[model samples]
Target: MKQALLILGFVLFTLPAFAAAPEKSGKSKAHGNRYQAGFTLESPEEEAEPPEDNGRGVEIPTLVVPVFEDGRLLNYVFVSVRLQVADGVDPWKVRGRTHYVRDAMIRAAHKQSLGADGNGRALDREKAAKVWMATANETLGGESITGIHFLTVDSRS
Candidate 1:
């Protein structure tokens, strides 16, 4: 191990290209600065631009729903959802009503199969989104939410 490490150190640090000091020979043009402490010209730093106005969104807690085949329990699929709010609708207001959304989702999951193809497969996203949309609008008393994004649908057996 010591021999191997010594050989590695020799190959790495002793290479003229990898040398940390200014080159004695004029071969320093190929490899840019390899020196740790030596002063070198750095590329210009990029200025951070302000973010564009994307509309609001609300996140709901993940819910676990059972997956079954032929009326027997197989495993659980964890569903995470995020609601995209319509323009002029407050996301925090939707966030405050997330419990209602979460409750409705859980109840709907119990009442119906949200999975597309069972056995560790993805959920039926369109169907699930429909349920979320209808439930959120009904609970919030308006169509405040424009979109339902299924963040994740992981099946565990």
Candidate 2:
């Protein structure tokens, strides 16, 4: 009977501690109330603005160059290039001089011997981009071009 009374007293004392609701503190109320009220904690001035869209740049047509090995044609390399222009440069100006650019690119490709060589070594893309940039800059009358990106380079034997 004494043990039963002791157990009942322990249950009665501990039940209130577990059942009581938590007190809403000031810090938690400030943070949670703002979110609940649909207001963001971070101010709009703290957010970064997106960059401006200048243009899509220019895309050159695909180029085909034949590979030679010891006086015989071995394979052909097909390359598509995109010339990325800097901001404020007009894409129409580059488009207007497409013929000269194409000619310059063809000459550059031929000079570089693009594609597999007689020793079966493949052309380097970095070297090709550098050459293309140089050629395009020379043809376009200035260094308005930011980069020369190779969209596709496929070789067939």
Question: By TM-score, who's the top model here?
Answer: 1
Task: Write candidate 1's Cα lDDT for 58-137 as tens digits.
Answer: 77898887655557665567776677888888788878878988898788777777666743344566777897688788
**Total clashes in model 1, counting residue pairs 3 or more apart in sequence or in different chains:** 0
lDDT, candidate 2, at 146: 81
Q: List the residue pairs that clash in candidate 1.
A: none
- Model 2 backbone overlap count: 0
Compared with the true structure, what per-residue lDDT tens digits does model 2 show for residues 1-157? Answer: 9999999999999999988856656454433433222211223343233233346467788777665655566556677777877667788889888778878888887765655333343445666778888888888877778887666666654
C-alpha positional error of residue 138 in candidate 1 after TM-score superposition, expressed in Å: 1.6
> What local lDDT does model 1 show for residue 145?
81
lDDT of each: 0.69, 0.68
